[model samples]
Target chain A: MSPKSVLLWTMQAAVFWLVLFVPQLIVFLLVSNPPTWELVLMVATGVVGVVHTAVEPSWRYRVHRWETTPDAVYTLSGWLNQEWRVAPVSRIQTIDTKRGPFQQMLGLSTVTVTTASAAGPVEIEGLEHEVAQRLVVELTNTTQATPGDAT
Target chain B: MTTPAEVPAGLPAAPEFTEPLQEWHRLHVRMLVVRPLNEGVAMLVPILVLLFTGNGEKWRLIASGATVAMILAFSYLIWRTTRYRITEEKVELHTGLLTRKQLAVPRDRIRTVDLTSKPGHRIFGLSAVRIGTGQQDVPGTDGLTLDAVTQQEAERLRLVLLQKGTAPRAVASEGESAEPVPLPESEVISQLDLKWLKYAPLSLSGLVAIGAVFGVLSNYADDLGLHPVQDLWEWLFENPSLALIAAFLVGLAVVGLILSVPLYILQFWNYRLTREPDGTLRVQRGLLTTRSVSVEEQRLRGVDIQEPLLVRAGKGAKLAAVTTGLGSKGESNLLLPPAPLSVAHQVSRDVLKVGSDPTTLRLRKHPFAALRRSMFRHTVPWVVIAVGLAIWAPSWAWPIPVAILPFAALVGWDNYRSLGNALDERYLVTRNNSLVRSTVALQRTGIIGWRIRRSFFQRRSGLMTIGATTAAGAGVYHVTDVGESHGLALADEAVPDLLRPFLVDSTVDDQAERNA
Candidate 1:
């Protein structure tokens, strides 16, 4: 697991929690006489927020391990249920590295591997620069060496 | 990154050719003069019309002055924007006044070079050479305008460019005799017979009909007071079960289709296709303004065979090829319109180099699976529509459901009949359609990714859909109507094994060579 991925996951968790709870908190504060239910909800949200922050480090560690594993890059992400996409390194055609302002601030980069078809390029976000470059070089060499390698 | 290297100096070296500046200078002057005159008339016509209708002098004066100013601006821009150079490897064009823009196109990408002369240009012996790559955003802008070159020189240039392995040289060095090396002509496997030409116009009419309907709708909207019509349009869009509106639209479509038949037939009256000596196919068509398009064999992505319901009844199929170019109207890259089923197969084998294998797998038709899948996808929408109509108007609810049944049944029948897939060592062909049947050929090397999808209900029913993706274009080919085990087996085993031979490891030509 790269240190960069841990930072990224922590950032994501922070953003997610803020987006989910901030508006509700603002609305509760705006009310003239806050109801008993609103008070209870606010306390519950505060507890959840504290728990979320505490668990974030471990979550980041799990995400980092899942991202860097060489077996297959599995994507289990969606609102309703996780849709698993397992693409082996061999099937990858080209690997592109990109870093936006946010990622650059966090000293992280993203690696996107594109195949021939247009379902879209599979992206693995938030990796250390050196690790990303190494992965790209290694994949390219392996793909070139093995003929008809399907991952 | 590779450095830009000079073109190899392997062929017999010749003196560089320079374009005559006199012709371009004359062309520039003529364009400057004619452009203003045309603009003046364009401006004058509206003012004259307004004057006859008793419009105010203030409006007329303002319009005329604005038009004159626009013409002056355009002419000045054209006069300032004139620079061109001919190099050994490419043609360089420099145009623009304040901020200059330069464009360079290689001679190799040029498929056809056409020299056209309007009445005025004809008198001046100035012809515009329209270069077509069949991939440009604009139709004729990719070519260059030669000012006053002789017809003989233009012909010579065209011949030199068209000939394989012959490098383009300047027209000024005609006195020095250069040997024209003779290259073996490409063998013509087959020619377009009368039968093939007859079907070429069917798809064209379909396009014209669609265009006409849109034109009519726009015109109607303008006549009905644009703002009010726009508000009405928004209202109509929000309402789903507007039968009267749908019926009116269907009527318009039928009328458009009817009126477009003659236009298509006229356009394709003298359709002809010839195999060029350089192993490229050249197609020439059009009645009033003749146009020619050439497709290189190597650029062909895949051959598509379509069997429309009517054509299927007559035992005929339409054959086309997907190529790497922008098609007419920036819609599709289908090269051929329609050919006989047998001829399509033969051309696919010869021109596209798609070899035939006696052991090629036959298409498997899963009728039950197709029916169920189609019912799930297509019938559900219609049923929903019916239910919505019932809820909206309780009085007509019973009749709406009865009316929707036939539509669902027809859709399911079409899906069951049309869904089929054929697999071989090199290619995977899937054929499916509701109204217009389409057979897609995907080379193993061409496939980039694939997915196997199964819903909870589908998983219980032992049915799944496998989708294959390709870089050539969007639209996943759904290998629908397969049992769960069969679909999983294909995704897990057969597909990878079948594609293994032609994947990134092997070259495209190697498979062709093996098949040959």
Candidate 2:
């Protein structure tokens, strides 16, 4: 994971926490009678938010890995818990590559592989822009070449 | 790749049919009669209402004639625009006037040619054709339909498309000879006997149908005006009494029961399944509105036999196909309608014909840890309700949980009893029950991968849920809450070699002692 992506995540988390925290802070300060426990809990939320934003992106980056074989694409990702998924090239309905502003700044993109299955799509994120583009083309070619698709 | 075009066992090879009759055939002209008749009836209703009330007399006669002209003219324009044709490789339909749309589906991709008819169309020997490609139907793109064709034409269309598209190279080569080969007789495989109607009331369809009947009635009332049943309510409130209320409820129930019986009969009357010589399963049924649906043999993965709680009490079950791309919308692909348990099994075996009956396989039971956890989970709600009721409203609801505890315990026990899974050389079977007990027999060849789920709670208890992911059926047949190692081992055994890299080292002392 790039330092830029970590900074982006932290900034996003900071905005989300601030939107929630500012109101509670203002209400407590304005109140004539404030409970000590409520003040302590409000402070705790800010600390938790800061700690979560600082650690999560890099920690997730450590555990996440993905690879595409000739006939299948596999992804392993999660933080507290991990899931490994394999999507056969034959069953792929479409492959899409997307880049949000944060990813663009890091020169990274996400490749999404979709199938008809109800388990939803498999996403391989934080890939370099050029690599993700090439991966999409390769996966698309494999899908088209496989004639007797199961789904 | 396509198989060698072998027919199902005991059925003779089918004769070759010519290239399906082409050109934009606009269904029998008589089909144009149905819509105009409906429009006429709708227009007639207002005229009749006006005449009965003895009002709007001056223009009433002219209004009737004008309405009939408008309906006939509009229906004729619509009928003129509707057209369908079958080419060598695709089925196409074109319809609509101002905003027109043309839909084309590849013949080989066609999953079902569902023929249906209303009583009006039936009187004229006409039917509607819905060509199902087994994909999620886009309103215009997927469900290509010809609103009305002669019954005879519909049958020939169904036969020609299924035979050519399904048989492919064999039929194409055979047709080249242009030889008049003798057609083989399709055997009557499974016919629903009238005695099976005893199982109708046992179905949840009866309840759903009852709700539908009420829904129709309410919708009709809304259309006419508010308070259509205001008099009935006034009478009901005015004459309320213990016995009268009992009689009223019983009367309403009887009405619902009456609706249920006819709806059941209409849905499943004379249900007959036939095996065409070309490996197609044809289902024909319905009383007022006849239906003819065909499922190709090549798509058969396996079968799912369901026994709902009420149906089980009567020793009856429902059989549905576990095929792919059958457009999972409000469709069960009823291979065998609700029937006696023995008959259901016999049909399942006969249909599958894969050496042994996968339904009868003795499935492995889940661990006691799962059952214990479920039992506590089930009873906890009742205990909470009991406590809450005891402290709050002491009189009425206390007896509710008095009866609830045992039922909750029974539900947990039944759920535990229903948990089982077995995998072997040819097929994998799993049995489980929530309200409806389902035993799914899936072809092992159809399975694509394994998804093992370990939630935080499951991890704490050393359990995992393993799903056999396939294209057919619900896409995943899950065996829940098995021991972690057992789940991994089952996945390994089923797929042969896939899960090895995912397993932890043998040096760790795991609780899955029974995995071996």
Candidate 3:
């Protein structure tokens, strides 16, 4: 993942955890005043957060190395384990670039590659507009020249 | 790109071809009439009930206004939806006055051309010309309606479109060669004989009755304070043995009847398969509203022959074909629904002209590796369901175990049976299916991508599922049952050989195939 992608993934994880746990915390505080079990649960959550922060450095390093590969582009990511798909520049049939509200706000674009097969599409998310356009042109040119090179 | 105006004009359009555009049958009016006639009575019945039982000027005014608006809207639609234009390069269809939507389909993309004159169209001397494309949409929805056209004109247009590509070549052939290959006239493959068509009219009626009964039952339940049937599902599961036995018998009977009915209708319903002069297959059917659909030989994907355990005793096997174009229904794209195995093979070889090399046929079966992979992916859910059910109700726990065995066995067998793949220099054929056996053949040039996936358990078992995706639709053909090594080898050999030219994976191609 790119540094930007790692940041996005981290944000997503933080948001997801907050959405899941924050309401429960609020409900507990409102309903039960200073309960020992609630206090213990709060402390456990804090410890988990600390552990997550501690592991972030190694994850960031791996993400940077994986994302910066010049040979292909990787899009999708996972939390504990990540799924990194790299498509060589030549295999792409069509490249569609899209900008959603959030991505547009952040000056990022999503690129979708359509292969001739029926397996649907593979998409790479969170690339700068100019970078995505350049990649599409480069891949299209390479694909046209070496059509048979894709596996 | 040439601008629309700058494009060079060709031959002169002769006097607007004053021939009737289509048979003068009022198809739109007929459709409008049927829906209202059939459903009007139901709508009016309730109103009539209210009018008799109670009195309200407000209701009367509302009903009258609604009826008037509906009539006006229908009339406006029918009046505005009249016009068709035929151009040299494409067929133009115009409809919807408010929106004035115009659809132009290039003659080249059209695989089949069908003309049908329903009773209304027939009486009006109007005919509807339906053009079928590889796109997934209702076949007859986009058609040209000619209000007045002679049979001769219809035939002329059909011949023109059918022989469009032959003219320049024909002239050239006349000058250079003494004998040009004559295009074959209509070659009838099979016909639905009337005897078979009559078997399941009663069965269809039975289904209608069943639907009506269910509707009434649901309506009654809604009227009363009872919950929907979903709530009663728990009661059925409470007695597992009784429920299972009842479900099995009913399901078997229903399935047997459902299958028999369509086959019966197809057997009788003018089900003639004819090969046109242009190497297109045309199937015409329906007693009341006779419909014809043509498919080009090039669009045919692959032929599938299935022998279900029940039908295995018979000498004949069911035949189906995967096509690039969707069927009239736009759901299942398989053509030649359950014909004889011999007919299927002949159609495959002669009509489709697919190569019969052992390599191609051998490549057709699902790789055994896929079976292990799919089994692993699928087993987790079944195990979870079983455990959940067992935990939910201890009394019914024994039945959960029994159900899981058959579920796993069936899935495993299906995954195993579905493995097969075939690839030729020109075409690729792969066969796979769980319940409905299917074989898909695709031209080598048409494939977009190839995918190989193996789960953690599948890797351990040395199995992987190989899938090929096509642009025609999102239906992927997968070879499911194979050993891991065999699967890997096949993927390594086939993906690069077939799709590499189309694939741009410079990184992986340079590196060796990953064993995992």
Candidate 4:
């Protein structure tokens, strides 16, 4: 994960909160007799969303980390609830890189490594696009050399 | 659908591969008899209701007769069209008149072969064989089913599918008949004891059975012109007697106990676990609808010793295998019914072929911070509800939530007591939960991945939860609320060097390399 990931995360959070707020805001503005308490609740939601957008990204960036070795892939991610996951090379089933619209704009990509077990998937988010591609190729080559059904 | 010509010229012809390219065989002719009888019995209730309740209309009689004829014809068509065969490479089924679906599973992927003989099938000496490959998410993709085959044939298929590369047994000759040959010598791991029936009531299956009986009775209450439940409710309301209500509850409990004994006898009348000569663990149970479920020793990942609250109070536990291909539904992987905890431990040890029971090992308990976290999680909701009721609702409602706090605290402490994890040489053991505390002993080699998680509160408390993911039962077994460093160390040790790179202050350890 890069330091720039905090900015990306903040932007993502803002977009998420905005998606929730816009509909309620539209209904409140357009509807003739919207409840007073609903407006109060909506305002509270806006305040919480703004505070969350301000605080959560930097905290998550401080917590998120990822590493890979010739033998395994390791990752620690999540904000309020953090997860540390490890998948071995011998058990690697597939490796792919995904770039969302925001990620494309920021020149970043997310690499996901999956194994046979449903519980074993290590996703490394907010990486430099070139670094993500190189990591995917490296994982593919190593996994090919490993021999097993991976189940 | 594979023709003999598809075998290319260059490859060596394996003997088993060349054989069993024989013919696609139809289900046993006796299935025509079994299927119609089974269908007729299922429709008996509705048909009787019409014949007895209708106003003697001629069309009602004609409709009942026509329905029986349709059932017979449909069953015959099904039997005629369904064809299955086992080749050296795959087990194939080509069935369905309308759709013409073809389903096949490679021989190597076959995981479990279940033989079930419902009463109708048993009457005709037939058994239904369900071949499962463990990939059950798809609707009709990998599994193959042969309904109502000759008992001998079902046994033969079971042996052939489970022991890959083995030549299938010859079909029974003219004199041998439909009687299944006795299985080869097997060592009995556990068998039903008469005393074990005492635990049946505590298992709570009887309560479910009683509830089902009430549900059916209520459905017919209007037809019968009687509503005992409604009458009882009215009488209770008129009298307003606490003693009467308590007496009714006691009566219900007695009925539940009485009902459970017979249900238990029917379900597990001759329950037995045996290890066959081929290294398959077989469970044979049920009186009327006899079932034989086999779990390959190779696919056996671990065992779960489950203690449901009521059953645990009676010092009993149920045991089930956590294996690949045997889906958890139908309790098909169950090794032991609610039996004495001692017997469960002994059987678990025997099944794993371990000298000692890993589930019974003394596990390292989580930190006191874990207890604090659990207590807060468990009791805080009730306390908040109480405070809310005090502010917004009537005074009596607040006392109700306040009254529940002690029980919630007890549950929290029980949950804390159950949380522990241990690593033996061969197995990684974990136990948790209060309602149905399960101690799982998973083979260390079976673990394919590791996940360690920390909530914001957990981070503040210096606690983390570790999950060991396998391809077996439930996919992942978690060790909740352990110290972060200890969890990382445990993960590293469970699968050598799998987590070494992630360990903060990593050191090159030669121990794992030497073990490998």
Candidate 5:
């Protein structure tokens, strides 16, 4: 995972909170008859958003980790709500590398490995772009070497 | 894996087909009678309305006759155009005149072959052969149906399609010469006992059925000039006596219980489970629309034992197969209906051929923190709601939340008690839920991947939910709220080396992280 990934996360969080914050901020500034409760709510939301934006990225950076062996891929992600996923190489159906606009700007990518199970794809997010490409190729080679329909 | 290549069992020894009839075959002529009758029955209400509204006019009779004739003509056209053929590699069906449609399911892909006969077809000794593969997202697209075939012919096709015989000679031709294999003996595993009917009324399905009927009626209540729910509410408002409302509820419960008895009889009149010599478990059931569903043992991933709350209270349970391509989940894979719990265990053991009952094995319970989590989880929300309601407005409804607190705690405690998981020799067993208690014994070999999830609360409590992802059953089975290390250990042990690379000692990891 890249150190700059924290910046990406903060940006994403800011964008999300901004959707709620902007209109309230506008109401507080522009409307002379703005409700007192509305002012209190807006300030409370702003404080939360700032605190989350500050503390979350670093906590997530410390928690998120991914590793691959010859036989399987293992990943642990999330700060407060952690998820650990492991998929055997023989059962892997597909491997994909994705780069959001923000991720691309930061030269980071997300790699996802899928099995036939509908549980979900195993995703390793915030890897350096070049590392993600290498991971995808490595997974593809391992899957091809193994025989049998993944399902 | 490819379809198991084995000796074709239950096939007639004498090669009936001397020449392979690769030619497309039309549906049985018997459908000509059945299809038109079915259409007429469907149009009966409209015909009756026409007859009554026409004031005994002769035109009404002629119009009804014309409609019947048109339906008969359409049925004839459909029968003529619909042609299905069993080639060596695929079962192909070509139908529809205006918009041509062709469906071909490969011979090897055939996972289940079911024969169904509604009263209309049963009268003429005909059955519909439904061929299903693994694909289930789209209902009709995943399966091929031969609307009507002679019962004997349907049996032959089922045998021919499912059996990937050692030598491929002739397909589903009427008189194709193929090597004759010995008929496989049918072993009866379990059959319905009249005493099992006692458990029928305990099932809440009757209440659900009644609710569905009410829902449909409510949709049309405006047209019918009836307002059942509104009238009931008005009555309750007028008479605020709790005893009357409780009595009414008791009456409704009685009605529901009585309704379920007939429904049970109608659905499971002649339920039977048998192991056909052909490596398939055949379930024969239904009183009205007789259905015979066959699940190949090769596709069997595991077995699931379900005990719904009411049914469990009565010591009754249901059994289902966790196999692939048997059709959509609940309806198709049910091996035993709500029967005795003992019978469920016995049938599960017989089906899996395991010496000991996997589901009944002793399970490791979740930690004490999990219990506290459940208590806090269930109690807090109601307390908050009560507090909010009191602050919002002082009302008679204050008692409602207070009264519900005990039940919520009961639910939480029950759920916590039900939380357990274990690893047997060949199956990883997990038990969960209080409302619909399910003990799933999934094959160790069938587990394709593992997912361990810990929410914010769970992380604080040192607990995690471990889910096993598989190709069969519900796709994922979870052991919820186990100690984090315990869950990791179970995941590692269940799949051998899959989770070993990721697991680390908590004590060491905590110290290292603190140092860093």
Candidate 6:
């Protein structure tokens, strides 16, 4: 994982905290009824958010891995309840690449692989842009219903 | 300047195409008439209520007539605008007045053709033709339909769209030549047996239908100026207790049977499954609104026999076709109507084209930890609720927990009893249930992946959940709360060599399972 990806994650966390905390702070100030626990919660959330946004990505990078076989594309992801997903090459209906403004700034992209499974699509995030493009090409080729690739 | 038809887009580029494109076709004029009638039928109840109560009020009568007229006018307008064409290469549709939407789907990509006619459409001998590619159409459903066409036209369109002239069943290689076209023949595998209706009330759908009826009644109570359930209570309060109770009992019995019988008849009235000579399965069912669905035999992965709570009690189960595109539409996926277990097996075997039923595998029992995990899971919530209530209310709350304990225990015990799985050469059979027992006979070839999950609580109990990832049936068929080693074994065995690379020795995982 890129160090910039972690930076991007921290910015996202900061924005989320601002959106949530700012509203609550405004409400409390209007009422003049801020509780001590609210202040504690605010500090706790910030400290946890710092640890999560700054440190969690590298740990996540440890558990996350993706592989492709002739028959399927496998994704192993998650921190707590790890999930392993496999989308078969023959069944792959669509492959798409998404680059959010922040992700574009960070030079990262998320590749979404969709199949007929009810489990929903598998998204491989934090890929270097060049790698994401190549992945899309490979998957798109597979999705075009030509199964005779000797590769 | 040359016409577009003269342009040889590459003579042999389109393998599915042999002949040239057919001219564009518009729906029958009856579509304009039938479309409004369908909408009018939906508003029938409200109109009936108004007519019965309004006593010829001028404004009320005018409002009803105007609503019907507008609907009829709009249907005619849309029907006039819609057009569809069948080319050897693809099926193209041009629709919309203002939007000017055009959709073209290649012939090989055409997955299923559904022909359904509601009572209103049936009156005009029309059926709604939905050509689904088994994928979500971009923007809207205009990509895949002719709203209402003549029944004969719909049938002819279905045949034209589905015909694969030289489309190879096997992987196409270079230098393959003119394969002779075969004659079209259909063999009926299973048809609706009225005897199956005995199991209809046993289906959970009936109870759900009854619930929906009551819900609608309650929602529209004020509008209708009547609340039947509330009225019954008021009458009961005014009458003697024993006689009223007897009357209520009789009334409930009659209402339940009346409500369920018609629903069953309408749903499975002419249910039939047939196979075409060129490997296609067709299903036809329903009464008032008849439906006919055609699915390629290649798309069918397996069969799912679902025995809901009531159905299981009566030894009946509903059979559904497990296919790739068949996932989104639920009821139309029925391969077999709810019937005796013996009959369900017979139908399934016929559908699978095998002499023996794949579901009849001797399933291996789950480990004892499975039972322990379920018991602990079921018991904890009620126990916690009971204790909390006792602390708050002291006397009365204690009895609630006591009353709930045995039932929870029974449920958890039954859950354990219901869990079993067996892996044979061809099919992976897994059975799990508490209230509704769903035993799925999933084809091994259909399974593309395996998912092994261990939640915090499950890890503590040295148990895990394993499921097979398939394109068919709910995608994944899970075996929950099995011992960690056992679950891993099942996952490993599901698609051999696939999970082997991801997993280490079961002993190492069990240690991590214990730690977690």
Q: Number of the top candidate by DockQ?
A: 4
TM-score of chain B of each: 0.63, 0.80, 0.68, 0.83, 0.84, 0.82
Q: Candidate 6 on B1-516: residue-level lDDT in tens?
A: 111223244442222323334788787788777877877776777777776677688988888888778888788878888888887578888888889889888877776788889898898888988886645323234237788888877876776677664233322532332442333447898888888788766664655776887787676676877777888778866774887678877776667766777888888788888986556789998889888888877767788888887777888887888775442554767888888888889889998888788888787888888898878888889999888888888475488787989999998998898888888777888888777788888888777566666776676777778777676657778877777766777767767766664566346755797899
Per-prediction DockQ scores? 0.19, 0.24, 0.27, 0.57, 0.53, 0.30
Q: Which of 1 and 5 is the better model by lDDT?
A: 5
Worst 10 residues of 5 chain A by lDDT: A112-121
> Mind giving the per-residue lDDT tens digits that candidate 2 earns over B146-252?
87888877877787777743343334364344443445678787997888878777775756776776676675566567565677778866775769868877876
* Model 1 local distance difference test score: 0.55
* Candidate 2 ranges with C-alpha deviation above 4 Å: A1-65, A76-84, A100-107, A116-120, A141-147, B1-16, B36-77, B134-142, B165-176, B222-259, B328-332, B376-406, B497-500, B503-516
C-alpha RMSD values across all candidates: 10.2, 6.4, 8.4, 7.6, 5.3, 7.1
The Cα local distance difference test for each model comes to 0.55, 0.73, 0.53, 0.83, 0.84, 0.73
Worst 10 residues of 3 chain B by lDDT: B11-20
Per-residue lDDT of candidate 4, residues B1-516 (tens digit)? 222233335653322212354579999998888998877885776677667777989988988889888888888889889998888679898888888978888988887878889899999999988887745334334357789799978887877777643332334353332333333567999999989999999988888898987887676665557888889888866777878878888998898888888989988989999997666889999999888998888888999999998889999999999986764446888999999999999999999999999999999999999899889989999999999999999665699888999999998999999899999999999998888999999999989888888988998888999999887777789999998778778888998877766664433333464567
- Candidates ranked, most accurate by DockQ first: 4, 5, 6, 3, 2, 1
2 against 3, candidate with superior lDDT = 2
lDDT of 1 by residue, B66-109 (tens): 76787888877766676655555565667767778776667666
* C-alpha lDDT (0 to 100) for residue B458 of candidate 4: 94
Candidate 2, Cα interface RMSD: 3.1
- Indicate which candidate wins on TM-score: 5
Clashing residue pairs, backbone N/CA/C < 3 A, model 5: B17-B175, B17-B176, B17-B177, B18-B175
How many steric clashes between backbone atoms does each model show? 0, 1, 51, 0, 4, 0
lDDT of 5 by residue, B1-516 (tens): 222235555654432332324899999998998887666675765667667666788999899888878888889888989999988779999999899889998877777888888888889999988897755334445478898999989888877777664324444453433344445568999998989988888887788788988886675564456798999889877778988979988988988999998888877889999988667889999887788988878778899999998899999999999976765633888999999999999999999988977999999999999898888888899999998888786587677898999999998899899889999879999999887889999999989898888999998888988999887778789999999777888888888977765665445786798899
Identify the runs in model 6 with alpha carbons over 4 angstroms from their true place.
A3-18, A32-62, A68-72, A88-91, A118-120, A134-151, B1-21, B47-62, B136-143, B165-185, B222-254, B327-330, B376-405, B504-516
Q: Which scores higher on TM-score, 1 or 5?
A: 5
Better of 4 and 5 by DockQ: 4
Candidate 6 TM-score versus the reference: 0.81
Question: Any runs in candidate 5 off by more than 4 Å, and if so which?
Answer: A21-47, A99-108, B1-85, B92-104, B118-130, B135-153, B165-178, B223-226, B391-394, B504-516
In candidate 6, residue B140 scores what lDDT?
A: 38
What is candidate 6's CA lDDT for residue B128? 87
What is the alpha-carbon RMSD of candidate 4 to the true structure? 7.6
